[model samples]
Target: MEESQEEIKRGLKDVAACETRISHVDPKGQLYYAGYNTDVLVGRVSFAEAVYLTWFDNLPSQKELSDFESSIISEMNLPEAVIKRLKSYSNSNHPMDILQSEIPYLGMHDPDLGDNSDSANRKKAIRIVAKVPTIIANLNRIRNNEPLIPPDDKLDFASNFLYMFLGKYPDELERETINKYMYLHLDHGLAASTFVARSTVSTQSDIYSGITSALGSLKGKFHGGANERVRGMLNEIKNIEDIEAYIQGRLDVKKRIMGFGHRIYQADDPRTKHLRELCENLCRRANKLDLYEKSKEIEFVVLNKKNIRPNVDFYAATILDALGIPVTFSTAFFASGRVAGWIAHIIEELNQRIIMRPTSRYTGKYGREFISIDKR
Candidate 1:
């Protein structure tokens, strides 16, 4: 008897994507890059340094960190042409829509995109990482009808981004909060959006193409949409008295609560603990602990009844709210941090040079003759 061809499984959840000297996760679902735990790194390192560590597999020295910071801050201003193109979009368009359009447009201006060599590709990766903050901040400004500000050399990358986006330098507490937010979002283990980025670049597509694909996937409601939904949930609750009833009503209708439950984390999202601590501190300092209290109440109710815990989106919304970012721009802020991870994954895929094409099991009949128009 002839043996059937070995059936290769598509979307192999059990299979490992890469075996390398790169990052890994602990049994507890916590992530590490190049032997450093993310929790330790977020506390000890700046957002830019963490990003560099992820891509380069080591923490940068003082001079290298300065130069990398300088390069990233230098590219924080979008070209006028890019801004002009963004203005052409209707005000009704979501900022993600604008991002999806602008990321691919980077290819038109970046000459390094044409060079597929490893060194050139790495440079291109840095360019993508550097410029995406500007693109995302510019989109926020355009949406608000505010003028864009060029990056200030004196400010660190995270600080300059906040300054440019908000027209002023953030206070020490505000700056630290924003840095923590960026650090927490720097990477997640092979999320769908990151996978999309990897898959696109695996085909030898340029960094711009890979990022554009990732942005498209991130724009979906199941992904980056949680931040926006969390704000909506907060708005619906309005007062302390309404929290329980509001949640109970939604639960009664079998509605899935936003900002709780993650695809990868069964018990709790590891990112949540860090963000929650930062937000709680910020809220306490601002005398807005009531908001955080309300959030905790909601958390208790959800966990007691539904066994769900708050994900990154839950505390992220609270932190951004405390930072005075508008609800509309919350997801844009998410895009800011995720762009770093997207670029890193894109570079990794380009280095490996595997086309990520997968086949679907054929469901249609194979042999069918087409009828002629005359017969029909």
Candidate 2:
């Protein structure tokens, strides 16, 4: 029995080698990519540059960056079939669900689906990244009964997304806010949904199908649901004065605050600080400093008394609120950024060609006598 137990442990420890490059956490739980710290990257780089780095593994020259932007902008139109399929979903269906269906539909439209060579795969990756924003923006427009605007090649990726979603050019600050938000959400350290994407692709599934599965996983409450909950919590509070009492009441009942905790970073989430700063600047510019102050008050109360730090969703709610992005569309916007990382991982898995299958330990007896359906 001891040897059997040892065998079980060994079976459980069988891990697969995936070639997809992922940044490791240092002792401090800080994430890095290819020798550069995320904090440094966030400070020094535009979101477009970060996405380029994630795909190509190097910073682009000015010309290269310009060409990259132009390439993505050129491919930003979704096929008409995809748009028609998106319209079939009810207006009340979650945007993420619509996204899940739309991604697989994209696979059907991809011309190079049969081409597995590296060059073809790379081009497909670019198309997926470029078109995901268009797909998500179109879904939002359809749900709201608004007219869908085709992508404008003149605008950068983030700017075009803002225009498509809002039907006008975003101001400089709004454009920057969208860019930063997209950049920050591009990837995390192999999150569960990301892992799901990799695992699906590891089975040699197409990239769009893998990402569709990932979108379904992300739609769950524990993953992408926090942002929506944060908006809901803010709505419930309704006024600045009610925040403390409201938070205290929730804590008294041992309820989980929507954006207070994180599974990976036990201290504070590093991503929160940059977004918070952006929110602060935006609020100041908009002459709505009072709202920012109220949010900060809640943050102070939550941190000092309960030892909870606001995660990305807390500040994301504020940033989207300031930019006039509706609460329901926030998670879909998150998907727009994340689809790049998903495509990257999917392509990486296809290159590595490793199957990800884990063994489960059986807790019940292996053999049992068959019984009649009505047996006592």
Candidate 3:
């Protein structure tokens, strides 16, 4: 049967599949998490407090934040078996693939693996958010044949992840940059990865399974890995003078200018404004302002030619590069922050108690008589 085009919602664009209290991207081009504007929350709140707000629907009090932060750091240690497994993998493996595969393996060791109670799920969420940074940092170290650095409990969430990754204490500037990055990435309402997570756990599957599914989804080029591509784009343009010609050439060929535009935001990605400034400051301090300038040129060219604005990933590529993170780990950095939001969506989906089972429209012919294979 042929259905009208109006009946089809490709990509489910603007489709409200379900309700969420965790976050929102409004038509007015602002992002909110639990009624707080993300712009307001990014610099002021610690990433831990932001995580707390996403999961619990409000910001934590001082004592609550302290306890929550401690709980996260305490769980950052990877099991010995997991470390050995990470070592066994080929260094050629992508970080996101390694992270995704290890999550289900980690699930096998969870004491409350079978429990889907609110309390149990919350605990699982903590373990996931905490361990993800450890997994990514260690994977990088293993690939480079360097000793892994353990998480520093004295440092807060963002600070500790930087410490583990860089093998040193981050200065206040670095700490502030990472906290803002993580907070900006903490959640977006029903993002592709978050939706995959919710759909997985909606079947009452384990939280680890839900998270694993989410990691795979986040690895997609159109989603989390766009920053890596943006970085690659930056490398392709060798000089500041070549940005326009390079962008125009790519556009003339109908190639996507990575890190530009968004599906949800018509004006500009609200997250881009903060990241743009952050990238500039980090690059300025690192004496790598050239990278920031090139990024701005690309943004300006794309905006002038296509009328499309830069999304969060555009400036994030420069910021991550300024922080000395390899392009390979870019999406893993995304997972490190987004796993919190995925868990929040998972917990909320569990409460819905309905499996996500959207049906597809079939356009093939029907009621035709079948012929036996021998008849032909």
Candidate 4:
């Protein structure tokens, strides 16, 4: 008789775990948020509007948007204790590490801690989205021995982050670039970090714990950190002449190119088109047009040789670089935007009321008998 076995889907590839109405990642490279095409949402809505849509399942009216924006801005100031805790960390500490460590402390200061009611979670979500940028910008400033810049209530969400990070109001182009960039990343299908967030909340945990777990996952190079890796790859090539040789050399050793392919999206990532345009314009304005040209050449080579298209991380790196961001802080920016998506997923997972426990295939010998220690 043949032994019975179960087929294993490594990495849960193509396994449908649960149904969600929040976003759809079509295998054909189209993305929709709450049934509205991202192409329509990208320029039409602000990041705060998109966050409202993700959480509430529809776009908000003018009055509602104003109130929502005010709610988020009101919570932007961190607690004194949390600020003190952030100041104590070494300047050498990675920003994501600082972010992960400080979240629980933020939860400590939450008035609604331990309350998982929908209203309470909604309030918690606002706090998470509002303070994440403050945390990242403040940490960067602290590392540079600069005094922390307070969030400006006058600016919108994306603009305020830029103002705090750079210590000046952004021009129109810079503000639009960040708005589109962050809106594009608001959510995708069950990405590694999103899945980690859903899984954490599946145990009925608090919102902060789930976000902390997601942060740890996002810090890996293959995930959110890919943007940072892409920036490093760009720095490695000295000039346009070095592009082809560098790509072929990496390919020759069977090394994975940091930003050329995605686990999903066989065609060009839908988000890439917007980001490519943004990168080009921002690079030109920042006098880094040379970087944009080199990025295009690298994309052409990787596509011609490997037949793989560049993902969101590829151009997103250049966009941040053009904005004067250090490569080390790239993923923190990613996390800052992505916390909105993570919060939405946590809310959805909590509603499912089912803990996420999957079975594993046992490949080792299962019938081996254990010998007593005395016998040995």
Candidate 5:
């Protein structure tokens, strides 16, 4: 039945589109993938293993994990043609714009471009996953006038991203840090980007197109850019003393204090716990605990003053900053993790073979008789 506008749920809040075995963000705000708790999976399972779990709904044994990593590394080396094309993009373009625009062209370079078979899509998924980090890293390198670095076959997914972006291997701890970041965000329950990706694939579009759709969805400030905004907020704070001033100032003006709330998590975002710890440790290691100190003050003040909890982006901003990632690329780096979820959802949508079309409540004027130009 067609319902009135008031009956419609804005943003599809509390709506369930389909059942998924891939992952769950339960009512209590706990996150799990393939029945394994996220806390257990992250730091314990490789990002590659996590990807395998998303695809197969089971953890990969060591042998399967090795094979998956091998497949991804072999696909990591982008074609020289793609490299030349990437070099031609204007340095002034936003990294997400460059990333979104490059994906379709990258799809053209794929051998399985039009093949929508499950096996073929999985192959394309692997390639897309492998190349996204490269695309993100190289695009920024071009912008900075730095020579693009190729992927390292010896490194795993996270380490290679650091290598490609930073032009050297991070230490094991640093490498593991990036890996954990990637794994922790591998899949979530039907986020906007995942929905966009799934909807694009429901039309029989290729994996690249699906991911391109997701990148566009993620480019929005609300969905994926919070971490970048958090970094900006931290920068604006400048010192620990300014934390309360900034928070109260925003509150006074009825402006959102970014990273303090979530649509899904009731109190605190589950991901915030690890990222908070990681951010503090990194700050301590670098002897640059000012940002961490400022962030804690902000969180404390916001919670007491507003009763709002900090989401993942709150601490993640400091964590990524502590690890030396530029604020410009923070969201794109977010896309790097989110792409795994996008792929998983795309695969699920295609397998289910349901085209997603929702009804809308139109409130435009009722139909009237049309008049010709010569009507009196």
Candidate 6:
């Protein structure tokens, strides 16, 4: 059957790719994971607890939380061979590429690499989520020519990443802010990277391979990498005076502002409020509160002129910047939280067992004349 123009979805916007119990994004812009509103989950539960709930569809009790945290901490260190390979890449590759390639290789060390059973896949999921941060941090450290900092098992996940980044355990408030960033980004419906991960695992491939696909998808400018662009925009508008001119110039050229809008969000991103507060708090502590103030001015101008509000990444860029994370590594920081979502979707798709192979409309001419080599 021939399809009408109206029937085609250019980017699968508003399309339901598959049924999922993992997370839901309501039209009101609120996000829910397995039946719990994410807004409620942030301060109420630890990031590990939230991640466990995403994978298992229920909150963990005291014993389960202890065991889950222990399991995750146990997987934080890379295999010795992987560590040696990582040290080799400290020269040139982008952090995202380094991470994307190394994670798939982690499957090589997994005892359950050949097993597609639910139980085996679950273990693989935990390993991927926990180890990705170490991979991201080490790749970033080596890229900066800094000595690698070992992961501290005593600290929680976010604080340990803090130690890796800043070479010290951050203050309690800073740790809490990092945890919030991780929790809010843990999952949000079936985002592009999650879709890619799910599609790869639908072929019954190993979880590590699926995550590699997800990482590649996220490397695109429009997905997880947008946060880096957001950071760039923030850098470009260094002074409060430049924001209006900056936004105006981009608007005059019809340039798409990277972080001002979202496909699923209606009015405002529900995730931004907490992040905005956290961004402000961190900037104040760093005594770089101008970054937050400048951001607010940009938001006011963009909202008035374009009627578009900032998305999660807009404020997140400032928070990350305040934490001393560079623009280059922002996307990798995003991936640390997003890995949990990818794992959740991969697990759900495998359970349902439906391959996500969407059909496309062919627009090219169907027939053509063939010419022999001597026809010319």
Report the lDDT tens digits of candidate 3 across residue range 40-99.
Answer: 887899999999999999899999999999999999999999999999999788889999
Candidates' TM-scores? 0.92, 0.90, 0.97, 0.97, 0.95, 0.95
Error of 6 at 188 (Å): 1.0
Which scores higher on lDDT, 1 or 6? Answer: 6
* CA shift of 77, model 3, Å: 0.3
Residue range 122-169, candidate 2, lDDT tens digits: 888889888888877787778778999988877778889989988888
Scored against the true structure, residue 252 in model 6 reaches a CA lDDT of 100
The 10-residue segment with the lowest total lDDT in model 1: 18-27
Better of 3 and 5 by TM-score: 3
Better of 2 and 6 by TM-score: 6
**Deviation in Å, model 5, residue 316 alpha carbon:** 1.6
lDDT of all the models against the reference? Answer: 0.79, 0.78, 0.91, 0.90, 0.83, 0.85
State the displacement of the C-alpha of residue 78, model 4, in Å, after optimal TM-score superposition. 0.7
Collision count for each candidate, in order:
0, 0, 0, 0, 0, 0
Pairs of colliding residues, candidate 1 = none
Model 6 Cα lDDT, one tens digit per residue, 1-376: 4543446787898788889898998868788989998888877787888898988899999999889988887888888888888889745568888888888688898888899899998888878887899887777777777988887778887778778877777788888988899988888887888888889988877788888998899878778788899888988887899888889999999997777888888867889888999988899999999989998998899999999988877888889999998778888888999899888888888888777777766765645788898995
Q: How many backbone clashes does candidate 6 have?
A: 0
Off by over 4 Å in 4: 1-4, 367-376
Q: Who is ahead in lDDT, 4 or 5? A: 4
Question: Which residue pairs overlap in candidate 6's backbone?
Answer: none
**Model 4 lDDT tens row, 44-142:** 899999999999998999999999998998888899898888889986788889999999989999999889998999999999999999998887777
lDDT-better candidate, 1 vs 2: 1
Q: Using alpha carbons, what is the TM-score of model 5?
A: 0.95
Predicted structure 4, TM vs. truth: 0.97
Cα lDDT of model 3 overall? 0.91
Worst 10 residues of 5 by lDDT: 1-10
Model 5 pairs whose backbones collide: none
